[model samples]
Target: MRMNYEENAKIFKAVSDQSRLKIIDILSCGERCACDILEYFDFTQPTLSHHMRVLSNCGLIEVRKEGLWNYYRLNINNCNKLTLFMMNLVTETKDCICNDKSKCTCK
Candidate 1:
């Protein structure tokens, strides 16, 4: 599904969670099975599955089943959409000038 701006914002917020961010970082490298993801975390199978479900729900990741294995793939298209939006913001807002301050709220 094509997520609108609000929906995509919710997705970014979801991925802001620590564990979820780690999951995305791992997937950023390449696709991995559910079992493989579980091996690196202290969470139980159900917990990891829940995190995967959230990621899938946000369209940040795509999933597939292969016999007894389930694989997770990064939704790079969605990622590109987000990246482009950020790039556009930086490009469009030519005079934001908040970056050079000692401390900025945008951070």
Candidate 2:
């Protein structure tokens, strides 16, 4: 409950976009340049840049520049943190919350 709700919301929002999620999927294969990613879609450069910017702001992806091209890769630490956060959410909370309002001490 004390977590940074705004930051977590930003991550969720960024990944909510189909384009951004596809970008993550592309990066999962390996690090790729903007040109490579752009090739997979029919959107214009500026539009793709916009999507990339959103993903970067979410702390999910990192980009590096090489000459004129930009390479994108997943931020393993942040990704791991998000994954662990979700896992903990599922594991910590008991399933029968509504039925038993007596002794729920699993936090």
Candidate 3:
């Protein structure tokens, strides 16, 4: 169940920004139009576009166009994959006990 380090790093980088992280949180509930997302912050449209581009480029979020509006949503599958990767990295020895070192066969 190994994951690509580069892809995961990109996702992490996309979310590393405060604004982008806020956008991710907004999208967590459901899909949203660009204007709706823009209303939550004080930044201009172009700034929001830049954040959205970075997010979409990293595959952390998805976009769709409806007339003149652009809708965005969290890419749940990719988000879940990233979550699993983090959990696996932290719990690499899930089957191993703290008291037993030599008898461990978790791998």
Positional deviation of residue 98's Cα in model 1 after best superposition, in angstroms: 15
Q: Write the per-residue lDDT of candidate 1 for residues 1-107, one digit (tens) a residue.
A: 22256876888887888999999999999999999998889999999999999989988899999998899999999888887766655563534444446666564
Give the local distance difference test score of model 3. Answer: 0.88
TM-score of each: 0.77, 0.80, 0.84
| Residue 10 shift from truth in candidate 2, angstroms | 1.0
Model 2 misplaced stretches (Cα beyond 4 Å): 93-107
For model 2, name the residue pairs that clash.
Answer: none
User: Who wins the lDDT comparison?
Assistant: 3
Quick one: ranking by lDDT, best first? 3, 2, 1
Query: Which 10 consecutive positions of candidate 2 have the poorest summed lDDT?
Result: 90-99
lDDT tens per residue, model 2, 1-107: 33455777779888998989899999989899999999999899999999999989888899999999999999989988787666655564554334376776677
TM-score leader: 3
The lDDT per prediction is 0.83, 0.84, 0.88
Off by over 4 Å in 3: 94-107
Model 1 lowest lDDT segment of ten: 92-101
1 or 3, greater by lDDT: 3
What number of clashing residue pairs does each candidate have, in the order they appear? 0, 0, 0
- For candidate 1, what is the TM-score? 0.77
